[model samples]
Target: MTATASRHRLTTAKAMVDGIAAEMERDESVIVLGEDVGAYGGIFSSSTGLLDRFGATRVIDTPISETAFIGLGIGAAVEGLRPIVELMFVDFFGVCMDQIYNHMAKISYESGGNVKVPMVLTTAVGGGYSDGAQHSQCLWGTFAHLPGMKVVVPSNPYDAKGLMISAIRDDSPVVYMFHKGVLGLPWMAKNPRSVDEVPDEPFTVPIGKARVARAGSDVTVVTVSLSVHHALDVADRLATEGVDVEVLDLRSLVPLDREAILTSVAKTGRLVVVDEDYLSYGLSGEVVATVTDVDPGLLRAKVARVAVPDVPIPYAHALEYAVLPRPERIEAAIRAVVGA
Candidate 1:
């Protein structure tokens, strides 16, 4: 079974869950496991109706033991099942880091290529709905730092569906993050009722490839997850002021699509990375370093990063917005980079 060629209208979150469900329907080896994944459809309904359609055997619910369940997913993957484990929230990943980074990620390599763990661990990250520090932090950097794992953060529904498919099919473990903030945004939803032909097939967008969402000749704005939409918003607002900024969505972080980053940087000669994670030792920093390391002379100005402040996410709404990178801040960074 494959993705239907037919385009459908679905909320970003709904589309992602549906995409995973579709994959499960297509492949017998596919199974979903997590607390409430079977009955409650996951904490966010990202796995809603999966158990009803696939039955309890495929969409199994587990106890609230992250380490045990995550390890179980890894073991199941090694034994041939494609397990899609829901971590509920990114903050909970710490409890199972050993299973993920130490075991799942290294099993294939440690076995001299004899074993492969094709698992997908989906989790939610970021702030906006006031979920607080623990539930709202973006921890992509931690997983991206691990060499044997593929880190994916989809900014919209289209990318979410495509990337999730890729993650499920990947031989190694993949950490797929669905940002909580952008899930309900209408602009990213698929048009399910459209009369256009939607193919009844399953397809995947290759990992490590970045999409140039909005092309421009001015400074390049590189970002991923919720930042992509924010950057695009800022780009639109900046356009009125004659700042034609190009927006590149760094869809997959682990593969680190360096070519896309380099090309965009080479074109604009000015780069601003807007990331939700902390500025220091985050994806933003890595991108800036990549550009300068590749060709320092190509830059017209110092690379800038608009990111969450180096502090824990605050519980207060105003304080939360203050720390998380906003469109205005991104615009400022872009302008600073381009000297506009």
Candidate 2:
């Protein structure tokens, strides 16, 4: 009952439908196909009350046919079944990118590993409510630059019920990605930090680990889902303008925690990456080539990113927050990488 008071009763889409109803009540092979996840639980309510407790044959409710229920959830996770598939829109993944990037992410390295998909696909990405450009994109770097999945991206509801119970007890394929403005959606636009406290029981947030959510030495914003609440509201408005921002939070982009982005840019030598996807080859140029692939002299200036520029997300909520990365473009890329 403690873990932050069981997150005040859940809402990053009800802690991702209580981590897919605690892995479908401790795995009766964890099924849950998409579109309105049974009895209308997930048009982003993310499986609310999971079809009155997993009835209707493990909460089945498919038909919008994203490539035939994501190719029957990758042949029910390659015949073993731990599926949680729900791609209800990370801009529809181009009507099923061949059942998510070629067979729920390359079916266990093309079967040399004797197939074990173990799936968790869930979706619903970003855009501040205009939901235009084919329902607003946050492609999570086109499913974390393809290759057998584990993309995650929970930025609240205690890492969305511990990364949806560690992406339903991962065996391989994951790609979770939440952020329809952090899923507090009572018709969007009131994200009190994606509703807090989470942890009623079944826990686990470890999947590449990057959580320095707000500690600072000067400027490091990095970021993930919902731009990690727009870099923690521009690290609490640039810490009252003195600007000691450091907000990492890369909660798994196909295991891109790269030593916590080089230990938060070696303790904030300044690096602002805040991405709601788009703005060049994604995830803010792979977190600035993961800190210049090791050490662009650990940044001193010129690293700011604040994404969404590659255009096409407009339905006019003032041109979709004029290409979101919002908290005023992550406070002008964390005060222009701390040159303030």
Candidate 3:
């Protein structure tokens, strides 16, 4: 099949917003709604110029009521519109949990397949930007626990664009999480042959399909979001010491690529899960449980999890850094797994 080929230099945030705008233009049913999404063009400039392009009817700016706007988005989806609602920051999802978890997610199942809520909820997640506890949070784990929602966390510009497009077109409620830290990095924009080969035309990376970003056999490192980059960095460092580690980026968390996790564990015989969420009942715990339950003999060493402590995020930069997982922590975990 022939593929669309185009190249552009843009930040991860810009690419994602641009992809959303493109999809909106292609589909008349698609609309954007959130505080400052129209006139202000979003708090992070992710939606700049959208209001001017799509006009106020499509690019709506709502009051500072997340619960109300999210519910409106859900109701709109139930009708015919494919609304893309921005929650500003994922931490603020608490105010709209009823709409997201109970209403939109359960509507189809609760109605015995009579209704389908095809909407995308985009939010900023992760720490390191000094946004304090309310703004800087990696709450993908919260939505992952929900039954019907698909959770996606893109690690780079390419994945960000493709995954956002996929989320927009998906027939179920999808939470598209963009990490605040990697939005403008030059490395994320690098045209690595692997990702540069991504189709220029709009396409979807199937949800729940994990990508082995870097392959090796000594140990398997499963992570997502900012942790994916950290794991890759640690893998590179370990390679210099003759320790081979395979890095799996679990781009979508809810429909987790369980087969990929099991296969990688079987090959490496050791596993380490790095997540930005807290240690208790988080992504790390879920991954370890899944691997151990599938094949106890596949693990040569006890599975290790590098995660944040089970505590509220501190406001101090030093304390925040100490709480979140880092490359050093991932490197240590890899070394421990490989007996290096």
Which candidate number maximizes lDDT? 3
| TM per prediction | 0.93, 0.36, 0.93
Rank candidates, lDDT, best first. 3, 1, 2
Give the Cα-based TM-score of candidate 2 against the true structure.
0.36
lDDT of 1 by residue, 1-340 (tens): 5543456655567667767877887899999999889888877767877888999999999999999999999999999999999999999887888998999899989999999999999998888766788988998987898889999888877777778889998998999998877676443332222112222346677888999989999898999988888888888898999999999999899899999999998998888888898778879889988888988998888888888888889999898888888777887788778777
Tens digits of per-residue lDDT for model 3, 1-340 = 5464676756677778777887997999999999889888887666888999989999999999998999999999999899999999889888888989999889989999889999999898888756678877898888899888999988877787788888888889999888877676443332122132234566667777899999999999999987887888788888998999999999999799999999999999999999998889889989988887887899999888999888888889888888888888888888888899
How does candidate 3 score on lDDT?
Answer: 0.84
lDDT of each: 0.84, 0.82, 0.84
Task: Show model 1 residue runs off by greater than 4 Å.
Answer: 1-5, 185-200
Candidate 2 overall lDDT versus native: 0.82
The parts of candidate 3 lying over 4 Å away from their true place are 1-4, 185-199
Model 1 misses residue 188 by how many Å?
14
lDDT of 2 by residue, 213-289 (tens): 88889878888877777678767867886778878888898888789889889887888887877889887888889
